[model samples]
Structures are given as structure tokens and as C-alpha cells.
Target: MLKPNTLALTVVLALLTALGPLSTDMYLPALPAIAQDLTASAAQTQLTLSLFLFGFAAGQFFYGPISDRVGRKPVLLFGLALFTLASLGCTLAPNIESLIAARFLQALGASGPIVIGRAIVRDLYEGARAGKELSRMASIMGVVPAIAPVLGGLIAPWGGWRMNFVAALLFGAGLATVVALRLPESLARKSAQTLSFLSILRSFRSLLGHRGYRVYVMLSLLAYGGLFAFISGSSFVLQTVYGLGPMAFALSFSFVVVGYIGGTFLAQRLVGPHGLDGTIRIGVACLALGGSLMVVLVASGVASFLAVVGPMALYCMGVGLTMPQAMASALMPFPDRAGTASSLLGICQMSFAAILGIVLGQNLDGSALPLPLTIAATGLMALAVFGLTGRARRG
Candidate 1:
């Protein structure tokens, strides 16, 4: 059993970690409204999301190294403050281009909490214990995606799409207050690393050169690539291909959330007994199975909604199972460079996902083939990379 304060701290960390997903998911239902209201084309409106991801990936490179030199608390506070201000900018933007720019800044600010939160977990724990804590955090944060779209849909009728930004602003403000008042400085000893280009380059090079870190980060990155592929293609596959209504599609999407929650629960229970590598292997197997099943089903001319969503739910579960362990393993070898490690890990995940999203968006062909094929390909790549690199190191 955990203490009350410990539980509260976990919840706070989870919320801090959840800011990115909440920002993205909560605003999804309003995309059409945003485009229509701002007189923007679909591609231009979509740039808001793409730019946000770009900013998110870029911001982590800076935040990680800076947090290592400074402290987690200050960086987190600065991020939350920036996120709040940027959310306000998003809410007040008079045109689509301005909204796109504001969204980019908002994602840049949001990246701080995410990268720092993972580093904070490393500060408190290590190895499988860190994996367990991260699994717990993932379990809690899983609820954000489940609720965000519904909340956005409900609010959009009353106040239009801009209200979504207002909600995000309030969330950022409240979280900032809680963090400012309660969160402790987890980095007990700060790194002597400076904020120079050469220093950052050296730090990144060091992390990238570590074979174990590279393997684990690649595993996580490929897993997220599959997930982002699903996210990018699901709406089209479900609504456009399978003819599901918006409400039905939303409900169907919840299955992935449920599957993720289940996977995290399983990870929390299993990580201690099986260890990080064992847990990750199980996750990879599940991911491969899910992706493979999707490909087979789609290729066999199964056009049912379950054919698409069922395998996706399984893929999401694999993501939940894989992420905590892989993240823990990736950062385990670099205690001194936890912030930098976390940031690089984040950059790879977001960058790959963003690229996958762009590719999937551009290749929509009115069939279920593209989405499932992408998922399967990514899963296979992740498994192959892990087996080759991870096994060689173990041997």
C-alpha cells in the first residue's frame, strides 16, 4: 500500500505527463470547427497538429540538457508557465496561421513537463522498480485520452473550438500551481554540463553510442510509430471505410484506451516478477501478434470494424506493456544523463510518430490496407531491431 502523499505525488506526476496527450486529444474534435471558423484548408488546419509535434520534438532537445544542468523544478515551472501562455495564445488567435504558430509554442512548452517527468522518475527509482512506477503513471495517464475528446465535443457546442484552448489553459495553470507548491526537486545532484552546442552534441553522441540505450529507445520509438500510424489513419479507416458514425467511432476508440489500461495493469503486476527485458519481450510479442493479425484480416477482405479496431486495441495494449520497461531500460544506463536520455528518447518517439503521421495522411487510399500494413511493418521492425541489437549485447 502506498502512503497518501506518495499517491498524491504520483497523481501529480501523471498529470504532468498527461499534458501532451490532453492537449492533442482534447482539441481533435474541434479540428473541423477550427478550419471552418478560420477559413483554412484541411491541410493548413492539419499544420496546427504537425507544427505542434515539430515544436514538441525540437523542445525536448533543449529541455533535457538544460534540466540536467539546472534542476527539474525550475524547468518544469518554466514549461508550465509557457504552456499556459501559449494555450492563451491558441485561444485568442484570430487566424489559422496564428493558431498554427501558437499550437507549436504550446507543444514546445508541454514538452518540458513530459521530458522532466520521466527524468524525475529516474531520480526516484531505477531498473525494474522505475519501470513499475512508470507503468503506474501510464495507467493513470491513460484516462486522459479516454475523456479528452468527449470533453471537447461537449464544450464545443457551447463555446466553439476556442473553448478547448481555454480548458487547456486552465489545466496548465492549475497544474503549475500544484507543481510550484508541492513538487520537490528530484535531481539530487545536478550535472556540470553547460548549455553549449558542443556540450549538447557530445551528450547526445554519448547516449546514441550506447548500444543498450539505442536498442531500448529504438524499441520504444518503433512501438510509438505503430501507435501514431493507427491514430493518423483510424478516423479515415473507421468512418470513411467502415462507415461508422462519429459517436460510434469515438466509442470504438475507447477500446484502445481500455486495452492500454489493461496492459499497464499487467505490466505493474508482472515487471517485478519477470524483470524489464522479459516484460519488454512479452510486449513485443503482443505488438507483433496484433499487427500481424490486422494485416491478415484486412488482406482477407474482412471489412468489419472489428477487423480494424480489434487489432488496434491489441497493438495499444502492446504499447502500454512496452513503453514503461523500454523507457526504464533506456535511461537506466545513464544516471548522470537522465534528463538528456529522457529528452532524446522523447525526440525519437515524437519525430518518428510525426513522420509516420505525415506519410499515412498523404497515402490514404480508401481502404484498410494502409493503416494495418503500417502497424505491422513498424511492429516487425521494432521486434527485429530489439532481437538483433539487444541479443548481441546480451550475448
Candidate 2:
């Protein structure tokens, strides 16, 4: 087998971890066009995103344990095939309902890469090394969110919304081919008890019972929640409320992701001197500050594109700093059961974001308040949770 931490392995891992963002970010610029073309309401179109999150959350729960039992490569290949097929299903979807269902199926498959890719990282490293590696992977994966929507916007005007799914299909196929040819099995030890119901239950209980793991997972969840609120609502808010064209909105979205990319790089630098907890403390402060600024801007009747995406860039930067360290901390304690721990953390993060996406969708009223409000709440909540939990642990 190839040596660990090679550039090739890191690239593959980054691509696998990017599946979630690739699936959502690329199609984001198409949401308005989809609603217009399908004769669906904005709320209905947003269901595609929310349901995708739900499916992603549900799939992570199973993919982790099953991969632990059978090994990572086979399960990952299966998921890639499913995702590729589902993307085709999305491209051929005839109506809004069909598109929604296909998006959900695509998410189910996408979750395998996301959850298992993290497990594979855990397989190879731990603690601050794991945090730095994850930051590297995230830094690489960050390009997808930055570029996918621009590509989608470029394609959507000429090829239409369905063409975005065609791009997704091709991406899935190409990634699958690479994995099949170049990637080795990352699971070092296969657990026979991984899939058993009792074993799964015990694993969950043990992971949840760990204080540090629980706190880290919550921190990750809140960080993601703040970021996702922007993901779910930005296209509409930027397009409808702020009069941005598809390309303009795509560029704006990419600008916000630059903040996230910068954060990942910052995490790499800080993880050594500040450590995971210190990095997180610095990061959440950014999250809270950016989020609060967004709320203030909108509440003060300042509803420009910059007003929204500006603060979001800072918030996303915070996410960049927070996620890798939090993930490394949570999964560090469960080296033997990393897959299970990864899945549980994935589920909590996605489930809450999924529900929050739906809430944002329902509350969207052609105003700029809901998106910023939701982001601010999640950011503030994360800061509060970290403070209280960290104090409790100290006490």
C-alpha cells in the first residue's frame, strides 16, 4: 500500500470530503431558475436543499458503521455509484417533485464520502496532527464551493438548471473512477461487531458520554448551522432581494467562501501555538461577531449585497477555523470507533442544519431579515455553548 499523508492521498481525501458542498454549491445559482422553469414556488424549490440535508444526515448514520464492518473502499465505491446514478436521475427529473426526490437520493450517496472520508483521516492521524490534516483537506476542498456556483451560473443560462445536475453526474463519475483506480482501502481494522444493533447502541452511548467529544460536536454543529443558513438562503436573498444576476450571485458566493478558505489556513497556523481549544475560542468569536454584524446591518435597514455577504465571509472564516479542530477533538477519543463517532457528529450537524434550512425556507418573505437572523442566532448560540461547556469541564 502507498504511504500515509502523501499528496495524492490528501487530494483524494479532499475530493471525497468535498462531495457535500459540490452537490449543493454547484446547484445553488440555479434555484431561482428552477422554480421559474418548474412552475414551483420558492419554498418548494428550497425543499430540494432541505431534503438533501435530511438524506445526508440519515445516510451518514449507516455508512459509518457499515464501512467499519466491511471496509472503506468498497462502501465508498458503492456510494459513488449510487451518487452518480442519482445525479443522472436529477438531470432527467421532469418536475419539481421528481427533482426533490432525486436530490435526496443524491445526498444519501454523497454522505458516504463525507462521513467515510473523515473516518479515513482518523484512521491515519489523531489530535493536532489530525486537525492540521483536516485543515489541509478542507483548504483543498474549499475550492469546490468557491468555483462550483460560478460554473453552475455559467452553465445554467445556456444549458438550463438540469444541466447543473449533468455536471454533478460527470463529477461523481470522474471521482468514482479515480477512487477505484488510485485509492487504497483506508480502514486498517475491520470490526465484526460494527453493524450489530447492540454494538451500535453501545458505541453511540460511549461517544455521547464523553464530555469533550460532546462539546466539540456541539461546537461543530453550531458553526455549520451558521454557515448553512447562508447556503440555504443566500441565492434567493442575493438574487431577489438585492437584484444580483446569476453570475453576480455566484461571484458573491465565491467571495464569501474565500473567508472560509482563509480560516482553514489560519487554523493550520494556530493549531500548534494555540491548540485546538484556543483556535476554536478565537474562531467562535469571529462567528459571533460576523453574525451579529449581519443582524445589525439588516435590522438597521442596510440591505445591500455587501451587507449580507460581507459579514458572511467573516462568519465562514470562523467556520474554517472551528470545524477541523472540533472534528479532530471529537473523533480523537474514539480511534477504534472513529467511523461511529464521525457518523454521530455528522448526523447532529446535518440534522440540525436540515431542520434549520426548512425553517429558513418557510420563513423567507422577500425580506433580508430571516437569513441574517438565523445566522446570528446559531453563531451566538455556538459561542454560548462553548463557553458554558468549557467552563463546566473546567469546574
Top TM-score prediction, candidate number = 2
Q: What is each predicted model's overall lDDT from 0 to 1? A: 0.86, 0.91
Lowest-lDDT window of 10 residues in candidate 2?
Answer: 386-395
Root-mean-square deviation (CA) per prediction = 2.2, 1.3
Assess candidate 1 and give its lDDT: 0.86
Candidate 1 weakest ten by summed lDDT? 1-10
- Cα displacement (Å) at residue 128, model 1: 0.7
Can you tell me which runs of candidate 2 are displaced by over 4 Å? 391-395
TM-score of every candidate: 0.94, 0.97
By TM-score, how accurate is candidate 2? 0.97
Per-residue error for 381 in candidate 1, Å, reads: 1.1
lDDT of 2 by residue, 1-395 (tens): 44587878888889999988999999999998899999999999999999999999989888888888889899999999999999999999999999999999999999999999999999999779999999999999999999999999999989998898898898899999998888888788888683677887787888889888889999999999989889999999999999999999999999999999999999999999988899999899999999999999988998578999999999999999999999998898787888889999999999999999999999999998999999999999988988889754332
Q: Which residue pairs in model 1 clash with each other?
A: none
